[model samples]
Target: MKLFKNTFLSATLTGLLLAASWPTYGFPLLIFIAFIPLLMAEQNIRVSGTQKKLRVWANAYWAFLIWNLITTWWLINADLFGMLFANLVNTLLMSLLFLLYHSIAKRVNQILSLIFLITLWICFEKLHLIWDFSWPWLNLGNVFSDYPQWVQWYEFTGTFGGTLWIWIANAFGFYALVQNLSRKTAQFILIISIPLVLSLWMYTTYHSTGKTKEVIVLQPNVDPYKEKYAIPNLEVARGLLQQTDSLITPNTEYILAPETVLAQNLPFGNFEYSEVRSLLRDYIYLHPKAQFLWGIDSYDLVYDSKEVTPSSNFVRDNLWVNNYNAALFINRNPAYQKYLKSKLVVGIENLPYKPILEPLIGNLMIDLGGTISTKTTQKERSVFTGDDGTKVAPVICYESVYGEYVTGYVKNNAQFLAIITNDAWWSDTQGHKQHLSLAQLRAIETRRDIARSANTGISAFINQKGDIISRTQYNEKTALRGLVHLNDVKTFYVRFGDYIAYAALPVMIVLFLFGITRRKKSPSYYWPR
Candidate 1:
């Protein structure tokens, strides 16, 4: 009973430490030692002569579920079932990952065990970025988001470097704690502080490299539940025009509106009746240099059988339609341009393993975007270019959460970044704030200024250094105009995306193979109880 009590308390302590290290309500320093208690508990389970494997997994699950619940409880404001599934499934996966590492510890030496643990975790995070059921909101590196001064090196290693740093610190810190205030305590302090000192020096001396450009971001403040879709697209366009009346200027090179601002589907290859275009074109003629960009629900009708793919919805025996959650770019030269949103939300935008999951689950997918239908996506990230050859990455709502995914745009010569989102679906919660924090990390990684526009809040201008230079409040109707720089120099992260995750993959595979083939009979080192 006493051992059980200690293990339970340790598990919950690890959870609280992790939750307390998150942004908006917590500090990043806690993350350095957050996993120590759990490590101790795992060590205890191995040494306490308890041979039950499920016991090890159960405690890990408890710890992970607690962390998931505390950090993302605000997801309930958006979708209860989605939130529940996210927590339940993610907890199981995380526990299994920890269990695998624990198994490897029994077969291999301590040093190899630690190495495998870090490599396996890094590989898991990398998989989360690409897989269909991706949800990387709690990646450990993100803990330093609110305090960018501590992670200025993200330009070189991206968020994976931060993840690596946290694990190394926790490993040494755990060792130091177990030694009872021994000489290694000083080593732990240096492990925690050395990277921070370097980051601070970079923050203080770094100069932004780019040409200054002005932009205007609009926040319509429309209620997503009742009125977002009920209104006509013409009315939405006119409302946008009215809001930007005073703010629109000749110096404004780009004008950004929130994602899905055009609730109705616009017919592709034809814009004769595009109300947003009509109003914007009339106004844009006055300031021909300004480009109007917005997120739209768009569709392309096809009778030609060759143009259709599996994503196309069958309208009749011979007709099909391709639906897109897309970005619409309007200017005099191109008149109208569209970029399909590629990275889709798991259940909302596209079903994970649709051919497999659909038959098994039978339509459990939910649409919190106010628009229905599983959205079809483009294969590649498309860069929207102006007449003067200014390139911008039109990042839609959920795509902003991905780190390496955003680098694809910069590689394609995107001079600046633009994020259009409708965060009102989650209402007033940490969901939107956490999202904005992720965007800041992207700004730092790419060294490109960001023009972020959102429906019902958080329209802002982020500099090349990840600072929110100017921003609007949540649940407010306003237009934000600010100057942003266009950078041609790409950061090391932008040049080679997530190299840490890449390097970790091969090491993980090799370690796993060795652990299975060369199992040791005796314990490497018994944990002192």
Candidate 2:
């Protein structure tokens, strides 16, 4: 009982440290040593060699649960059930990974065991990106988002690089402290310092030089709960236009509006006939040189002959249809291009394993005051080409969280990124703030200017270096006019795309096999009874 209490205390301390070092609040420096206490708890369990598995998992769960709750409790503002489900399930997944490492450590040398832990964690983060229940908000790489100058190197490695950096620093720092080796501790400091120094140097030296385009970003400040759906689409369109009319000039190359600015669900086939389209068409008629990109809730119905997809919703009379949370781009041409949001939020936008889980737990889907449906997505990462040959990546709300996923747009020749989101659903909580901060990482990774238009404020322009040039107040009805330089160059991260996580997969397999094959070893240190 005493041993359990000590381990539990250590785990809780670790969780506190982790939460205290997250972005949008707290110091990121603590992350270097955040995992030490939990690791010590796990080590104590392993050394004791009695009820090792159970104790390790339990301790890890406690730590992860506290961490999840502290950092993401704002989720409850959107959905109480979703908040609980995310915290419990994500913590369970993290604890299971740690438990796997604990099992591997028992049979292998300490160095190999550490390697397995690092690689396994990276693999887990990688899996989180691709999986149906992906919640990469706590991925260690994102810790540096609030301090973009410290992670200028993200342009080469992506967020996974930051994840690897954090893990390596924590592992080495923990080892040095455990063994009480001053020289090893110095080495850990050096390991942590080199990256910071390099990031600073790169941040100071880098500069963006290219054709500049003036952008006007709108924040409609429509309440998702009361005003968004209640107001007519034409009135919403007129409001957005009225806000941009004075701000936009002939030099205004792009006008960005928040996600679902047109709250009404328009049929994809007759999108041109919609009043929302007409308003935009009239605006484009006046400013023929300027391009407009805004979010819309759209749907399309397919007859019996049309092929059905996994996301298709079926109706009576052999009819199937799809609902899209999409970005519509209107240029001088009569035709407009649309990019459907691919990276759907777990319960709000998408139902994971829908063919199986929907029947069982479908009603549990949380309604965050937006279009709640199994949203359809497009396969291609579409880039919106402008009148002057410049291209912009139309990144929807949740899609901005994904690093490699956004790279697809840059790879397809997007010059800058335009992120449209409705962050009002979560209100004025850390949920929206964190979402805005994560976009900084994307800006640095892609090395492209970002024009973000949020529904309830935080509309801003981020430079190539991930610096917020100008921003509006939260929940404000305002518009931000700024000039974002258009660059044709692609960064190394955009070219390679999460290579660090991909490279870890093979190394993790090898380490896991080696750990399993090696003979069992006793700990070098003693555990307190």
Pairs that collide in candidate 2 are: none
lDDT of 1: 0.84
Q: Candidate 2 clash total?
A: 0
Give candidate 2 misplaced runs (Cα > 4 Å).
1-5, 362-364, 524-529
Please report, as a residue range, the 10-residue window in candidate 2 with the lowest summed lDDT: 520-529
The global C-alpha lDDT for each of the candidates, from Candidate 1 onward, is 0.84, 0.88
Residue 169 of model 1 has an lDDT of 91
Tens-place lDDT per residue, model 1, 317-356, is 8897777889988888745777888888777777787767
| Residue 113 alpha-carbon offset, candidate 2, angstroms | 0.6
What's each prediction's clash count? Answer: 0, 0
Scored by lDDT, model 2 comes in at: 0.88
Error in Å for residue 37 of model 1: 0.4
> How do the predictions measure up, each by TM-score?
0.96, 0.96
| Alpha-carbon RMSD to native, per candidate | 2.0, 2.2
